[model samples]
Target: MTARVLLLGGTGDALAIARTLGPQHVYSLAGLGRVPADLACVVRVGGFGGAEGLARFLADEAVSLVFDATHPYAARISANAARACLAAQVPYWALRRAPWRAQAGDDWRMVSGWAGVVEAIAPFARPLFTLGREPLEHLNEVPEQQHWTVRCLEAHPGHARARIIDARGPFTAEGERALFTESRIDVVVSKNSGGAATEAKLAVARGMGLPVVMMQRPPLPDAQREFTSAQEVIGALDDYIKRSSNA
Candidate 1:
């Protein structure tokens, strides 16, 4: 029997790894995005109920290896993946992109969670929020005077004081600079979703001497293996496949 692999999709690294692994693998998406990227592998959308459901799916599919390449903020899913994989006695690995470090000229106030972001941005009226749609609900507590310029993949209906820029990322520094200037944004609020895709805004903010309230990444569930790059993940998965074949 062929040893099947399951990839927790959503990030660019997930797509790249799936492309390398070919059609034998299963790519699972959370169905959060309005339009998910089309991939080469067989794609499964939505949740697996929870940890037990995921374990059942892994067992039913005979998945030998699990690769979690979901977004950094996807803490619950990641934890579930880790638990499910362990329960099913399958190898689990997480491909986490490196966190962004502060550089010279970067005025950053690193925060632990969403509440910290509210406190940090309380003084600023014009704040550009790049933390995505789900977390925007937390901002309802903030006063209406703090108008937000939110960038997200899908349009969120909740924020009355927010001007939603319905767009995806991998944005350029020049483009971000123009946006901050045009919006007259006084502060930038973002989660530490590391990678070149959405980091240009940070560079632009630094250049403009703007203060950024950067949310730290939540702690990941302990995995048997953890990789930082697509290449590393690909190599590891390849080795696992080869070993399984020999076994």
Candidate 2:
């Protein structure tokens, strides 16, 4: 029997790896954002319930290897992938992009959780949040002294003191600067989701001399093999496919 691969993906890097997969491989998503229609591999949407369900799927589908190309902050799925792969006796590989580091003149305030974020931003009158939809949940709790500008994948009608900007990135530095200027953003709140796509905001914040409240990344389970780049993972997967075919 041919060795088939299972790819757990949601991030842009995951999509890059998924594009390289063939008919025997499967790309699984958690049913958020846009699903790609154009791929040689099968696309599976929704959750596998948890580790037990995922292990069952791996066995039922005869998946020989599992590649996790999820977002840096996606600790739960990453943990689940590790557990499921172990249970199914399959090799697990992961692609984690390097996180962005603070530079000179960058006023980065590292925070652990939502409470820490709230405390850090308390002094600022106008705060811009780029931490996905987490802020949306607390729209009702907006401080009387502050106005919030939230940017996420989906647009929502914000409350009196908050406005939502629905956007996708590789945001340009110039555009980010314009946004900060127009919104009069005193502070920026974000997660250390390291990638060029959203790194423009950090540069703009640095140039404007605005403080940034950064959320710490969660710890993830270790994979059998870990890659820093998608190209490296793709190369390794290709080598495995070739060797399996020859065997």
Candidate 3:
């Protein structure tokens, strides 16, 4: 029997990999989005409890390999995937996009994590937050005097000082420019989720000479192999299957 593959899904990279792998693989989403993307593979939504639950699921399903193409900032899920794959004795790989770097004319204040973001934006008012729904709670740490305009994939019950814009990405610089103008946004606060889908805002901020508080990506669990592109991951997965067959 052919080995079963499991893809920890959600990001554009995950969908691209699933499409390339066809319908034979299993794709799992965390169900955080209002509408999950349709994939060609077998789709599983919601979490598998935690690390223990994921290991049990992998055993029950006889999953031979796991591909983690989750969001860059999804530290907990990535950690769980690493632990579960190890416990289940399955081969695993992480597909991460290249991170964005500071460019000429970019006014970037690089910070390590969410706490750094809070501190970096302390004096700035009219902030545009693109850090997603999970970190919206942390906005409570910001002083009430600063008004925030948050843009995310889903609607979140944010602080009274925050105005939420529910939208998806593949955003363009022109559109982001309009948003920044309309919202009177003076600063942009975002995580370093590198990819073209949501990167236009950074360029727009830079063009407008707006200050950007960039939060660095969290550390990923050390995997045996890591890739930066969908094509590379596809090739690696094919090689992995070939090796499994020979074994």
Each prediction's total of clashing residue pairs, residues at least 3 apart in sequence or on different chains, is 0, 0, 0
lDDT (10s digit) by residue, model 1, range 180-200: 988899999998888888989
Best by lDDT: 2
Ranking the candidates on TM-score from highest down gives 2, 1, 3
CA shift of 225, model 1, Å: 1.3
What lDDT score goes with residue 1 in model 3?
50
Residue-level error in angstroms, candidate 3, position 131: 0.5
Model 3 lDDT-worst window of ten: 32-41
Find the candidate with the highest TM-score and give its number. Answer: 2
Candidate models: Cα lDDT each: 0.85, 0.93, 0.86
lDDT at residue 40 of model 1 (Cα atoms): 65
lDDT at 134, model 3: 47
Error of 3 at 242 (Å): 5.9
Query: Which runs in model 3 stand beyond 4 Å of their true positions?
Result: 34-37, 138-142, 157-160, 239-247
Clashing pairs in 2: none
**In terms of TM-score, which candidate is stronger, 1 or 3?**
1
Model 1, C-alpha of 166: deviation from truth (Å): 1.8
